[model samples]
Target: LKPLGFEGGPELVCQSLAEGPFGIESQADVDSVAMPLRKLVEGDNSSAAFVIACYSDPGLQVCREGTDRPVFGIAECGVLTALARAETFGVIAIAQRSIPRHMRYLRQMGLTERLAGERPLNMSVAET
Candidate 1:
């Protein structure tokens, strides 16, 4: 961010939910954190933008709807960045099971056609 010419670098805000899963490996885990994430975004008043770092982008839409500030999803940003530099792009996922979910998300974004492929590292989020 500093290299991009912002006076001060981006701030990092990390939150943990009382009952959320240790790792968001499934859709159920993503669903479990959505409302909590949205609440976090809504409660924030200082940040100029919010970036959800999760690959599944849990609560991205809800957070955007709850706040006036810009909201970005890491997955969305990565994909868009790749698209800007190439004709197509591939995704490196944490697990094989996650590929299907990512594909669904790409389809939702109407970017499936631009996807070269997706491969998994067969690792857990914590391991990665």
Candidate 2:
């Protein structure tokens, strides 16, 4: 990230929620992380930018509302980047249950027309 001109480099933060499901395979799983994630980001005062890390980006909208700092979601970034380089692109996901959320996000971005396909690896979040 430093080479990309992110001064001081980027910090990577991991979320290990004890109360939620281990893998984000469903909307419920995604919702389970939202508040916790929002709280985590809200408490942090020093980050110049925050990347949600998860492809599902559970709390992205809520988190963004809580901070003035730029917030990025890995899945959104990947898809947008791909769109910039290709007319259409496919997504490789960790679980089938996540596809709907991805689709919804794409639709919200008004980028579904650029999606070619979405394929799942049938793996848990921990495995992949």
Per-candidate TM-scores read 0.84, 0.80
Please tell me which predicted candidate would have the highest TM-score against the true structure.
Answer: 1
Question: How accurate locally, in lDDT, is each candidate?
Answer: 0.86, 0.82
Q: Give the least accurate 10-residue stretch of model 2, judged by summed lDDT.
A: 1-10
lDDT score at residue 90, model 2, on the 0-100 scale:
86
Once fitted onto the true fold, the runs of candidate 1 whose alpha carbons sit more than 4 angstroms away are 1-7, 123-128
Mind sharing the TM-score for model 2?
0.80
lDDT by residue (tens digit), candidate 2, 93-126: 8877788888998899898888887878875456
Least well predicted 10-residue stretch by lDDT in candidate 1: 1-10
